[model samples]
Target: MASDTASLRPMPAPERALARKRRYRRRLRSRIILSFVIFGFVLTALIASTAVYLRNRVEDQVISAALTKNNNVFAEGFYRNPDAIGVPFEKIQGRQFSTSKLDRVPDAWRALANGVHELTEQDPVTGNERVYRLAVRKDPDYWFFLAYDIAEERESQERLNRALIGSVGIFTLLSALIGWWSAARVMSPVSELARRLQASGDSTQPEPLAPHFPEDEVGQLASALDDYAARLTEVVQRDREFNADVSHELRTPLAVVKGAVELLLSRPDLDEKTRARLLRIQRAEQQCTDLISALLLLSRNERGHGATDVQRVAEQLLDAHRTQLGGKPLALRLEGSRELVVDAPESAVNVALGNLIGNAVKYTTQGEVIVRLLDGAVEVIDSGPGLSAEDAARLFERGYRGTHAEHSLGGGIGLSIVRRLCALYGWRVRVVPGEERGVVATLTFSAGNGTL
Candidate 1:
């Protein structure tokens, strides 16, 4: 609650500057804390010294203004001199003070001579009980002994101490307020920088806000951030333009491929051999169309700005492939959860999966092709001659061919299409030996889930 109130308060320039200082200089927090500690120590020393000085000075003034007479009141038969009782002031050894010449000089005489005394129950000189203010009145030639007791000096000292202590309290409070205000001022700019950096993550590139202290470390940081943001923007812009170019170019070829495939399939051939050969050509043409579509999907995925109906697309591709591979003594096992969602265009998933399945049907002379979808992974297992260890290592690379399937059609771009599409979506691809005497290639969309 207090923090909100402070934030809402119209921030002064000093407070904002201080906040910036603190943000960039996390060390500044510790420094300010240490400064306050040192300040407290110094203030304590100053206040305590002031209190002591006031106490001693007031005591001196009170003692010097008092009147002293004879010591005449002792129930134990101590005779009163000019004072109530003649008591001598105890002089410290090796200290230059009054010497006793005039006998039984009073407290008033000591006060006038700028001398100090203590009134104690015990006599300082002889340990006998007495109330004493024994001092000397020093003339240019001689010193006179004085003895008397006064209570006003001790009381005055107490009052002075009280006044000094109050002043110290007020001073400490003011200092803390000023310190807190200064700290808040320095932290403001630092917080702004933090916010901008956080927002930068979402954007392709975000320029840093202008810093108040551009000449200092904070300024250097802001300048560096702006440079980084500009670089990032350039990279993103370049990638976007590249994707756009690829998409536009691939669409025309893909349309021609589809038209050719449909034209061939619709033809009424003359003989069985010619029909079979035409079917082969039609199938090849369809593969070319699929490749072009996959390329377009890769382009779209690279741009990474769309709401893709991945599940619907994947199912549609599976239906088409199921029709294409009809009467081939092979079964396809597709597995997915009800919500098999993804992060790229529907074309991306279809192109990627179609390449894998098409390759499977091409190589697999017999047995089952399993399209397993667990989590976000799509694995195609075919009962073809499995990829050699050497080939599997570089299977997804463009134009790469395996030892067993060296004569495979479509220029070995099936897996490469898969790879490029996965790149667009930032998916992981793994090609390993299938459980049986076959091969398995997997496109894992673990990262692409949230990419949309």
Candidate 2:
């Protein structure tokens, strides 16, 4: 029951969604647009970052230079006159501590070396955080320090940062537009070529694509497609001619053989053995003719409509296989509905039923092969060694044979042909292990293709 349910289930929704996503990502135009967007974002980000870094670096250098020069002048003036007042400035403060009064220096400033250092301190008047650059010069006789407040510089830097960020966003938007336009311009000719190729595919003769475009990459692709189409058309023409010729030529000899067998069977007093041989010959000729017709239809990849009686075809196939059983202790039986009919050619139905019945008969050496006909389906169940996982997975692949087929005298294409016929006629075929110890092969016909 599990196997039967799985065999009939459609593709899951998640799998279909994943397949769609993969196809979407594979489009050349989408990839091109994505590339442009990424390039724009990265280039703008790098430039904005560099601008911020350079602005901060130059501002620090200018402030440090001014502080160092002022501190040096204040130290020289203090050494020249011990009672000189502190260096004058609005946002800049100069301090000097003699060796005797070194403890008067602020603890935060006393530990500084001779270089510009940035420090954050609480404002004495506003009770707010203040940021300043400290320049220090230490000597054995005195220690000199200069502090420069950079609150205005901080505000300016913040504004510049915001402006740069907005520029990055604007540039990114412009880049996206450029990418969209470029993708459209680049993919236009290719899309047109594809359209023309698709239109050509529906007709008997395809229109030339190279004549419509300039000689560039797209044009070269169009020329190559034209060449491939021409070669393919020639191959298809030859194949059609060959199938027609074979059908015509082989039917003549098959008709002669069929006529001779009928004539021989009509005679009375013939021995049982001789009559049986003639009957076998007749069945063989009929099989050959049916195979030729089926192969011709397959070669043309066309379906011929007919109201084929499903039960009748199954019985004929079972009878043919039963005769070839020879000394094998096997039974061939038919069960289920008798009125189920399929809207497909008798030849195709015969070949499909013949292959399934043939496989069952071939594998089951001493057990029964039952053909069960349903309303819109038929099953060939054999009491033989059951299907394996590997066999069930790849049984319909051309040239693939089952483990049980090792000793069989066939090229392993019978089931492949059945698969193709099923697809062509809107039918479905699946094989699975039976309930106990055999294989159940089911061929189901869809509505409108099969009827009661």
Candidate 3:
């Protein structure tokens, strides 16, 4: 059950990239500024850490050397007098112990080598730990221990660390400001290039972008864009000319066929079957004319304005399909509102709505094809094989065919053209599965596009 539900869900490949991209995605300028800030922060931190390490090393070496020298002097003076009143230095405390009384030394200080050792001991009275640099000297007759106070040095180290931290923050802020300024300077030409390119796109002829920029990367990009635009403009102009020529050339034959059909339909002595065949030919010619007009509009990417009767177009489309049904036990229908009208050319309406109706008539084998008219929309519902998720998703894509379209005679661009027409006219169209069976294709006009 879970697998079935998962299979039915939307899991497009781009979802993962989109999810991760949102977290780390940044504008180009923002990324540049961030890079500068990170570089400044890391450099300052490394320098501050090195300064602290070197200061501590030098201070330790000096303290160790002084302690060793002073301890020797203290031992020498104590031995000469056999007793000393106080110590040689102000912050130095010396302790003398006989070799026989080794156990008298405190346990924390007993295992000392003949060098400097730093120890922290808590004072019993204040319950505060005091750091000391202890220098030890062992002799055959006596053992001497000298301790030096280093609390001031520790305090100075702390003060230095605080100052370094402040300096790092200051430098980072300065780097951020510099990065912002540099980014603005660097992006200015690109921004102007983009602005000019956009302006050129909206115009019939574009101005040369490379002329406005220096001979640099931006200029190179602008030159490339100009070349591409020129080629594209030529292609577009050739395409428009071809469509115009085709439309102009085809109208002559279609006009001849239309005149002949009208002349034949006027004959009163024609038999019923022959008249029906002539009417079918007339319908086919009309469909061809409407298709050409729609294609021309599509090529030009323009909308033609007129008040088209929805019911009349739907009835005409259904009648044409009914004749083409042949021996199939199928029915074509139009239901609901009869007063619906659209503010669009009849040929445009005929093409868009006709595609929907034609697809229904094609896929539906025996059941009915119903055209339902709403207030501002038309729905072509068919009692054929229902739509699939994949088909519904890609129904409007150019050159895409549904699963049931294997034996169908089409290039799979009818719905794509319909979609383009809707876009050009500010309308909407969609295909969805019907409630029970078959498919329902709806063509909805915008509020400004029609009247009930």
Q: What is the descending TM-score order?
A: 2, 3, 1
Of candidate 1, the 10-residue stretch with the lowest lDDT total is: 1-10
* Candidate 3 wrongly placed segments (more than 4 Å): 1-25, 76-87, 100-108, 111-113, 123-129, 448-452
Cα lDDT tens digits for candidate 1, 1-452: 01110001124456786887666566764566457656965787686887697767775665444422221112112222323333333321111122453444444344454354555676569876654454443544344444444445456567767776776776666666666676667655666777777667666556465554456666787788778778877886887788667766766776686677577667776577665666666656555555555665554444444565555655655665666675778776676654556766555566777777778877777788877766566667888877666675667667777676756566777677666655555577776676657777766665524333
Which portions of model 2 miss their true places by more than 4 Å? 1-25, 81-90, 448-452
Given candidate 1, what's the lDDT at residue 54? 71
lDDT of each: 0.60, 0.86, 0.86
Query: Residue 51 of candidate 2: its Cα lDDT?
Result: 93
In angstroms, the error of model 1 at 11 is 40
Q: How close is every model to the real structure, measured as TM-score?
A: 0.41, 0.91, 0.89
Q: Please provide, for model 2 over 287-356, each residue's C-alpha lDDT reduced to its tens digit, 9 standing for 90 to 100.
A: 8899899899999888888989988888888888877889999999999865888888889999988999
For candidate 1, the per-residue lDDT at 109 reads: 49
Q: Please give the distance, in angstroms, between residue 176's alpha carbon in candidate 3 and its true position after superposition.
A: 0.9
